[model samples]
Target: MVRGACTLTAERADTDRVLDALPGLWQGFSATLIRDCRLRFRRRSELANPLIFFALVVTLFPLGLAPDSTLLSGIAPGLLWVAALLAVLLSLDGLFRDDFDDGTLEQLLLAPQPAGVLVLAKIVAHWLTTGLPLALASPLLGIMLSLPGHSMGILMSTLLLGSATLSLVGAIGAALTVGLRRGGVLLSLLILPLYTPVLIFGAGTVRLAVEGAPLAPWLALMGAMLALSLLAAPWAAAAALKLSLDG
Candidate 1:
């Protein structure tokens, strides 16, 4: 009986320690995020593809549409947002492919920390790689597109928020398709409809800027969408990942 009591106490102690550690478990975010960034940066082609795609789309639009600043300026907000959206979509297919291939994805799912938090960190790292660069590169593209110089801040701001939301939304689709051999095409199809509203508000925000109109309402909506995606996407992604694992 004494030995049984001692064993029960030890088990209780182990459970208590795990519960105590839960508070600090979110630090896993930093570790996973850093690791993701390091791995992505090591692959130069993967890191550069979306940025190149973004720039190419922006550069081609004015030539294709005629070089008139009036025409270009009118379409610039939608053009920029569309290009950035496609760039992110292009990158989304590979978001989980590497980890899924090498088995790190399995480890992540089984980790002591919540899988949702880990997935969120990874999505953030992806945005830092694919989305943030697009946002930063937009001002130069804004110039080429003949967007009003005064609205350059609006261009950058909208892309920053919109692209992060895209990354989060894209992660859910990527998780759903990660196990497939040719998921890229299907991934785009799955996520693009969901991406439409973000494109609308994002482009609208910049258009308001170009028109010298109040941007607060549009910007506020984009911010709300980002907040909603941040809160909900990780959990949805984790559930999708579990389904992938089960399959």
Candidate 2:
């Protein structure tokens, strides 16, 4: 009985520590995100390049898939949105790689703040850099893909909501794989399967509209996913970074 009581006490203490750390962790995460954004945008041209590349990738699909506007319009939302997802995935590696390579990641771990907050901040920076652009540029790509103007709004909304979740989930995989010399491929390997659910719902939201079906359930699921990832991914990411540091 005493041993059980002691175990419960220890668990409660750990939980209390995690709870106590939340606010500072959140602040530290936000600060790191801002710093990363500033550093990334210092090269304005480089920062804009992802948008251009996303546009280019979307344009290539119509040419490669079909020049038929009818077919393109039917498939536009899925293609363009999924393309945006892939663009973010392609760029996710850079989120932690630079920090890891230059030792900024180590400082992040050693900071007075909890690592979870630090991870959250990195993810916030990542969303700002990769996900936000994808959301903003999605409409243009939507048009290129022959998506109807009405559907374009939905496309933008879903991408904005969905990409936030993507960055969080991707960050965990990025942290786990960061220490590996050849991590880029491995990161994708670990993360892509995890990303499919978001892609399904993100693309499904538009598909439902295209087919004249109710969108509430799909969008709700997307929101649920975002909430789940937002609530959970930071801690997992922090743990992965700790492991990486220890190794």
Q: How well is each residue in 40-133 modelled by candidate 1, as lDDT tens digits?
A: 9899887999999999988887768798989998999999999999999999988998899999999999888899999999999999999999
For residues 1-247, could you state the per-residue lDDT of candidate 2 as single tens digits?
A: 9999999998988788577454465567667878988998886786776677788888888779878888998888778777777788777877788888899888988887877777887788778877888898888877766677777778888999999999999999988988888888998899999999998889889877777788888888999999999889999998998898788
Candidate 1 Cα misplacement greater than 4 A, ranges: 1-23
RMSD of each: 4.4, 9.0
In order, the Cα lDDT scores of the candidates are: 0.92, 0.83
User: How many clashes (backbone N, Cα, C below 3 Å) per candidate?
Assistant: 0, 2
Q: Mark the 10 consecutive residues where model 2 has the least summed lDDT.
A: 20-29
Local distance difference test, candidate 2: 0.83
